[model samples]
Target: MTIPAPTHQDMLAISERLGLGITEEQSKIYAEVVAKSITTYGPVAEISAEDTPLRPAGGSREHTVPTAEDNRHNAWFVRSSITEKSTGPLAGRTVVVKDSIPVAGLPMIAGSNLFEGYVPDFDAEVVRRVLEAGGTVSGKAHCEYLCFSGASHTNVTGPIRNPWGDGYSTGGSSSGSAALVALGEADMSLGADQAGSIRMPSSFCGIVGLKPTTGLVPYTGIPSLDAEFDHVGPMTADVADNALLLSVLAGPDGIDPRQHGVEPSDYQGALDQGVKGLRIGVLKEGFEVPGTQRAVAERVRAAADVLARLGATVHEVSVPQHRLGLDIWSTIGWTGMTETALRHNGIGIYRDDHYPVSLMEWAHRHGSAIDQAPPSVKLFFVISEYVTKHIGYAGYGRGVNAARVLRGKYDEILKDVDLLLMPTTPMTALPLPDPSSGIEDELRTSHPMAFNTAPFDITHHPALTLPCGPGDNDMPVGLMLVGRHYKEATVYRAAKAYEDTGEGAFRP
Candidate 1:
């Protein structure tokens, strides 16, 4: 097959399609200029045999390792378990990193055929922190394909079911991270949340997950959805473990732009402070939504009563804009994430890049991975491409502005309350839908799952989800507490307060 360059006629047609009025002569000139530019810059410089390969940025393992057992739970994509006997805060803990985050020499599928068999040459910042703190690197948890869906079935590995209920969904894209911890496959795990991935699964699986303030935890080596919205945090079976993990992971790595100029805090120091005098604001709109489950809502309200009994005041606070959080998240995420996915290779947002260039190039030879991705990922790309091309991405900017306005509303309310409380998801985990379900069905089931958690991702606030005991069919319910940006200590304090009740964070 011969590659064809764009003709002057093609250029003219494109200009017309874009509503640019240009003469034939101008089109001809611009087409030739573009051809010349491509010819001049398309080829990379040739390397000599003497040239050295890029050195691995961090410590190295002997070689990539594989899982000892590949089982039905499908919770883990790779298992290269490592236990170092050093003593530190996380000593004797075995933790897994979400497949989207790199762990040196471990095969990371990232729950997509797009990244199958890719292994990083270096560990992610969080992985290094866990190892240095004496925690064991158990494996890489399977995530949703491209980390785009809130359902577990979207991954290449099939569904990651809730440990609590055999066929129920483990609210995702951090499915395996929560599943493994909930099942005791690992003591704790690292999860990445772009739009509620961490907290949603934590909610479904009855664990504790924290989406730290945007810049509070460095996102250096995690595969990104959007740098601005990307967050990496800890998921554990209890609040104390979560806080201890957060203490280790929170700090500047001097490389991630998100962590630039940010100071670290002692998260563990304030966790036991309790919510004695803290005022908790229950966001009225969060529970009054159309399909909000009564059982889940009642559990969250009951959780507020528990907090109130612990000496915290619970007030019904209304932030109407909170309802638009899902819409805004969609408007901003669809276009931005589609752009990144279309890039095919890894997005170059972090230092010490570990792009699976060979695997991606090979996959490209067969077909575009975007075209083959699961429904949610495909829908995002197709719709975003059309919307951005024809209707323009004006909504993306408006969405950003709306996020600030929403943040202002929360901040204003925060002036009168210490933290905002709500359900982590609109309902408890739903039964796993059929694989052949329509996109509409998937969207219908998943659209509201992030309503309560996506807002904080947009506003850069610290939000935490802790189990509020069982609800609706005895499935777990999650109560979320949102704090001011970088105020995760307060979020943890309140969560720890609930955990102290000895009723939350159930283990299956």
Candidate 2:
């Protein structure tokens, strides 16, 4: 069965709505991809083609791999159990779930083989929410094995390469979820973030990610981090869609033990209220890096003007101990890692029953080695408390305490600020990082991960990342909005305000 190609009209419609400047020729190709997906051969075509066929300027149909340039893809769309149809707010839209969440009947391997036959007893809390919103589950999004590595190249899934290019990495553990959304295979996706998993991939893939305030969404049937930072959040292409989904997903999930007494807010209403008169804080640490991407900075600066026009005030602010966050997060972050790793029978395999390899062994051998350390990436804490810990991966009492102090500083800073704004990545996406360059690719690729998103995880605050503009190379860059503890509405209002102003792109 041949998948139908997106009609020329379909291309025009999608292109207009998404604002992606696609050529008529590219549109035809995209339609072809869609047409082919509904038939029985759809699954076979997805993995068997190795790549799609491409025609040159002269129309010679040469073989072309399905890369990010496709803007649409079905090949290699990793996933979990799917619903042929959608049910709520995101109805008709395709979505992918990260591996950590339970999807009945699929291999809910959590990126490791240890639990291959372990059918989830039930749908995850977020899974229930997505289906209720009229959204269809496309597949379980591929992820770093066990959601352990920041880079997406786990042995089980190979590397979830950036759709932009084959050799480059899509920053992860949430890597596959981000890739699917970026590739336009799905409307949006879900991922769990304990540290920078959600934020980094969002930033790296040139999309948007929202790590809701702790307990905003129920976490039943999903894995947990430190009991401090595990959050299941939305990762999407548009800021508006993210706001839309939050409305559906945010609510009391009696199942998440962490939500002991927390109640979620009305996120949709908050978006309409917008950011006028809000105080958007500039986290001082975000721009402190050398070689920070100027394009990203310019867009954020322009965003401030839009906010000002929308009636919000922009001010530069810094927490007292931004430097110490590295220490605290490392300690706290890794302690959670070791403990989480200990939960698995295959600290190294995607399916423990089907595959017997240990995960850490694989990661240690293949994960981004710690050779390319950026001046700002701190690993002293991640190593000591998490990675190598043998005590069931429990090792962060000290770092967790230090993180508390850092949180206190952020709390004081937020006392007067409605939301915080920062450059999502100090630099835009670079070429595939070379770890042999003497630093961990993880460190270099994610210098801003700790400073931008990690602190919120520590403070129990909600944060969102938006694509502001292209950096020097025209690769996407992002801006961040962080709210005070559980004040996601405020953050939503502020970002929506900036988006409403329409002054979002870089002028140059």
Candidate 3:
């Protein structure tokens, strides 16, 4: 369906219903931002003023479903452009960007205090790609601090709340990006997924999140996380949008030394090709870990059934090392965190990298230590090893080799199945429990960590997180479809099939 752009009145109502926290003037300003960045610059101030659209009475679920309605995000280049005269299939579509990456003069915060007033010197590779393809950026998004706050809040910016209920979680690092797309405030959003940042938020917010194979796209001009753990991808309401954005954003830039020889493909057109007669594999082992809500499992299985019904031969398979993925994921993530902690500290790019001083001091004070304990502690030990050891270049080499095994497994898995299906996040959106509450802090609500996300990063394979359904609390659950190294088109085609079958909705 050709969805129309949202009017200012439509946006204020949506912002209220979806908990967007934007004032009507801000909505007007947002559109003005779009006009300021493009060919039409003077029209925003000239537009007639009107009262905010009255909130619809207890809006229906149709209001919740995305319809390409986006107006609140148009200000200050929140995302890429969408206009009548843009370009091909994805031309005239508005796209949103995480503020971390450079988009010409837009401030590239990288979710940190250090770059407090830093605007980008030039467009990041992804931004150039979008512009070249006729897409205009609407505005930049707010992100978690250093994009490290897994619960998706930023001390430097603001929270992107859950669409189901404003009081709940939106899942993050890429927090605002998810909310924008899930609430139909933008057609597509570009976000980074390190330790499931993109997928986690996408799952919670009821949208599609693609955690593309690591290195499939350039990671230059952004703060460095461990190169292996970091990946850039798209978040959208549907596979068509996901594919379109990927087509624009995936490729090598000269500045990205790791980008090497890899290249991505045309994703939007591939969705229409369908996944009939393809081999589909359901990840049987390690998909369900602690806190995997029952509702999540049911929707994933429902999506599997849809794939089978569509003539994709479905088989349940186990990746014995997927368990290793969880363990190594911590090593992968925490080590990157430590490295980021050090990298930012050394460079002194942020405003307050000074205080929170001696993370080593903090680690020593609040360090998790035990004489003898559970298998999970081994992960802590690995982190401790990273903290104590100067893992510099050689340690990195070993980590890369360890991660590549997951890639080898992906190669094997894809040989038999055209794509692998798994749940994106183990549960759905959660309550915003106080992070300071010791009892609440111990709860493990998010389970879609390395078990589902790490492998794709390690293997450099493309994976898409598609909203399958919601749990008991009405928080969204995402079903993930992982494709071969460069075969994102096939995966999107398969995902679109299942998405259309209504398997992506809540089960009774």
Candidate 4:
């Protein structure tokens, strides 16, 4: 079918929007020219690819058992028993993929009804690797709506209560991933982290979580925040399990483009190495954030001493720029959030970013459900859109530049120390905020959660969080160990050394 030609009125509107002051006569001429160009191009090609193996060695899995309707922790979107290759490192281990990452044949709600009934016909690279490596795909874990909110209370399935017991938060958007692992519902889970999503929930629920160096684990087939900040890694009950999962998940998929030239690592190789002779820098800014509970600080300091006693040298390191991380991250991250949320609608440039085209088209069909997004996402959409309109995307550019400065500050400190140690969160898990509460209360939930964790997302460093010990009210505190880019092996080793001392144990 030939394309419909644009009317003179349509051309006038387009010209006015572009600041082209063409008169009525010029509008007719320009409209014909534009119509001819569109006609020559024919209809817009469907962005969705057919259901076939796109990446080599991308095996499939049988959805043997269907997802259960409900569960104790409200942590899973779909609970099924699935495995393909039965003999590998992760054999017999049950795992959940966060709902934001595709796992073919399963309903990936992404914690929102906006994508109901939208099942992908292909698996995410990480999901494929898990099946091939003999890991069982247990279910889809809950994430915050569109994986935006850091608080666990924002999911459409229901609020993910903390495993530490009632009333407390299981910091999110990877809410159920941490909750399930912490409560022993699953052995391990894959979590995508844009701004501390994996680590925040892990810290809140007292599990071990690693946000690998960006681009280390391919973001292919996962709904993303932005290509620059996207990452996927493992959340588990212990450092050993986390390391084991990373060994399987890390590597190029040959299709992500971001992973094209990247070489993978043997993450399990240095796990048993003691932290002897290692220099650990305790970040000063990490402890100075307002609202940091006294016990949370004391607990992290005590862990630093434990590393010292275990033969690692520990000292204080200051990076003043870190004080600006939240602001810088808010500017860039929220702006990117808006761009990504609307990108499939042709609202922005398509940079060949990793997105499930089929799932997106399904979402488009059910797009009206987007109004059900929580207050946090609504706030982000409104504010990010307003800022972009007023400031013309220059704020995002400035934010990226500021992030580079912050990354340089971290690099300067890392040059003198093997790893940077800090509290994973400024405070232990706080009580879940009332859903009907005012915006001020809702904002309070995430303000202190990612102060330390978000910076690494910006810098693309490998950061791991593990249980340190109980803090105020017996809530668990996390000791975060951050390593240079692609040095997750060193991060794992330090975390394992701490784990060996039995200081980070949480048997809930």
Candidate 5:
């Protein structure tokens, strides 16, 4: 395809919009120069627009949108059987990916109608790794709209129901992934997290979720909210499966800029190692967050006691800066999401990454429809846009600086303690909001649940959420274990030790 050069009239209109104040004669001269300069774009445009054929290692692209009868929880967006290898660590394992990630021929809707029929021509790095490791790709699971909410009701298909109780929230934006794994629909899942998306849902649904250290897992081929905070990791029914999946998914692919010297480790090897002799710190500020239920906090404290009984030295530790995590994450996340994702069509500039050009084009075409998004998505857009226009980049800059201080604070505490323990969420699963609810009701249910988990995301620490016991109404309570950067082995070891007690299982 030939590149179309801008006409002199087009240049004049562009100049006016940019407030360039150029004369008509200058526009004509500039248009001629631009035409010559853009002639070099012809080959680049031609290559980019050309169709790139896909060669999936094991899975078939044939799929179907599951019917209501088959999707009682509204968990699956599309169902298919995709497997490449027959023998490996993940052999015969069913793995469902969150809808936010690309899976070759399946629609990557990201829980929004803006990308209704858009399908990727290639697999995300994680998906490719899953198939290569002999894991069967079951299908794509639905999530919160554009992954903006911490509650589950915002997905376009429907509210993802919790498997444990009726009409309860499953958490977001990895709502479906958690539900499916809990329901035995899949053995494991890959979930993305910006503001505790993976851990929140897993906590609510009583599954194991790990948010590996920032940059430990390559985020290539997945759309991001903010590159710095973006993470994709494993969700499973038990700690061992989570560790197994992490073993396959972690490591750099040399494409994503987020991976900073990341090296995959023997995650499975660390699962059998008990918490004996480890100094586990119970973070005081984690249980002190507002909206934390008394029962939930007590449940986590009991889990900490179990660790102490198992030969680990457990004691309360406080990092006061933990309270400010959400505010700092909000400032950086909102500003980065608006400028990088919404403005740049999910592929921000100035990075060496495998740009999904087709996805970018689709986003650019449907960008205007964002106004019709769900309440949570709309709220983020409004707040982010306001921050960009009125507060400018200075706000985001300060957030980045504050994040450094917060990280240092955690690091200082981590120097004394081998791992930090806390409640993954302040409370159990919230009830699903009614459809007739107004914007305030919708927004209320969606936000404020990430107070405990969001801090680790910014600090680049590894955090794992495992069910501690039943809480109010017999709802599952999750105890989180946080480890130093790139020390997922330690996090998994503690979580596995807790899981071994058979106490995480709720008999309700």
Candidate 6:
């Protein structure tokens, strides 16, 4: 590929767009200098154009969009069988990967029409790890459009239904990942979290979802909303399976810049250790969030009490700063999405991480079509653009600083407790938004479920959601256990003890 030099007229147009006020003569001079400077890009373009070893090494596999009968809940985007190893820990297990992550030869729509038919040439690091661990890549699970929603209805494919209830949402943007696991279509699934995407859906569907400490699992090859909050982890039918999957996925890949001093532990090995002597903090703010149903809060509290019975020291703890987490998350999330999704074609710059060049090109080609996106995505665009145009990066800057304070507050509590317990979502699976509802209603269903789960994403803590019991409307209530950074083992230990009581099972 040859680099194109800007013409004098092109320079003038660029100057006008940037409000540089360059004179015609100045534009001509600048064009000449830019043309000379771009000669250096020839080699760079040449290297990029050449085929690299980054492309997955394998024969192409066939994939099919599931029929309505095969995909009753609209959980699977595409079903395919891809197994790279014959024997390993995950042998004979099927793993459904969230559509947000790239799997070579499979279309990664991320539940958005803008990315429709865009097949990645390389596999995300987590996907490759799954294959190597002997897990079958059963399919690509559908998610919310551009992965922007906390509720399942925003998926362009259609609302993903919770297996536990008819006409109910499977909280998103990892909606399909949780549904597939709950439906027994897959033994485990991989899910990404920016704001409660994994844990929220897992809570709604009665499955176990772990959002590992940020960077515990390398995020290379996955498009990031924001490096600070982006996390990819395991969603499984049980805590043991979740722990097993995390062990396989955690650690630095030498490609993701988000990882720093990662410490991978024996996730599965620590499961049987009961919560004896463990100190558990029940977050008061978690239960007090507005819209939190009394039934849901009571269910989570009962689960905490059960832990106390199992020899764990349980006590109420308050992190008042937690109340401000949602605002901070929104500020950073909207601004980051604007920079990464809107301006940069879902591939942010200023990172040394692996770039999905082909995916970025495909997104760029269809970027103009984002206007046809779902209401939730449009809401993100509007707020992000508004903040950027009026508030500038100052809002994001303040958010980052506030996040540090929030993290400190949680850390202070964690010093006296091994894990913090809370509700994964304020409520259980909500009724799916009506398809005929206007944009305001659609937007309303998007993010309210992430109140508790979003906070840990910003704090970079390892948080896991396991089914505690059934709540209102017979929907599964998710009890979230948050651990210190890189301390997923402690979270699993406590969760396993609770699960052993058989109380984590949904018994509606």
Off by over 4 Å in 1: 1-70, 83-85, 344-367, 436-440, 505-508
Tens digit per residue, CA lDDT, model 3, 145-184: 5566555433344445676777676777787788777777
The reply for model 4, stretches above 4 Å from the true place, is 1-36, 39-70, 345-355
Q: How many residue pairs clash in each candidate?
A: 0, 43, 24, 0, 2, 0
Error of 3 at 492 (Å): 1.0
Clashing residue pairs in candidate 4 (N, C-alpha, C atoms within 3 angstroms):
none
Per-residue CA lDDT of model 5 for 243-296, tens digit only, reads: 999999989887788786888788889988898889999999999899999999
Model 1 CA RMSD to the hidden true structure, in angstroms: 4.2
| TM-score, one value per model | 0.87, 0.72, 0.72, 0.92, 0.96, 0.97
Model 4 over residues 235-268: C-alpha lDDT tens digits? Answer: 9999999999999999987667667567777778
* Model 1 per-residue lDDT tens digits across residues 402-429: 8888889899999999999999998888
Best by TM-score: 6
Root-mean-square deviation (CA) per prediction: 4.2, 18.6, 17.5, 3.0, 2.0, 1.4
Model 3: lDDT of residue 311: 85
- Candidate 6, poorest ten consecutive residues by summed lDDT: 48-57
**At residue 207, what lDDT does model 3 achieve?**
87
Backbone clash total for model 5 is: 2
For residues 1-508, write the lDDT of model 6, one tens digit per residue. Answer: 4568888899889988989999998988998899889888768866866645354749976789899998899999999999889999999999999999999999889888889878888888888899999999999999988899998887776788888786999999999999999989999999999999999999999999999999899988888888879999999999999999999999988778878788799988899889999999999999988689988999999999999999999999999989889998988898888788888878788887667788888888899988888877877778887877887899998988899999999999999999999999999889888888788788888889988999889999999999998987889999999999999999999999999899779865
Across residues 137-174, which tens digit of lDDT does each residue of candidate 2 receive? 77776676566656655425355777665666677768
For each candidate, what is the lDDT?
0.80, 0.65, 0.65, 0.83, 0.88, 0.90
lDDT of 1 at 399: 79
What global local distance difference test value does model 2 have?
Answer: 0.65
Error of 5 at 508 (Å): 2.8
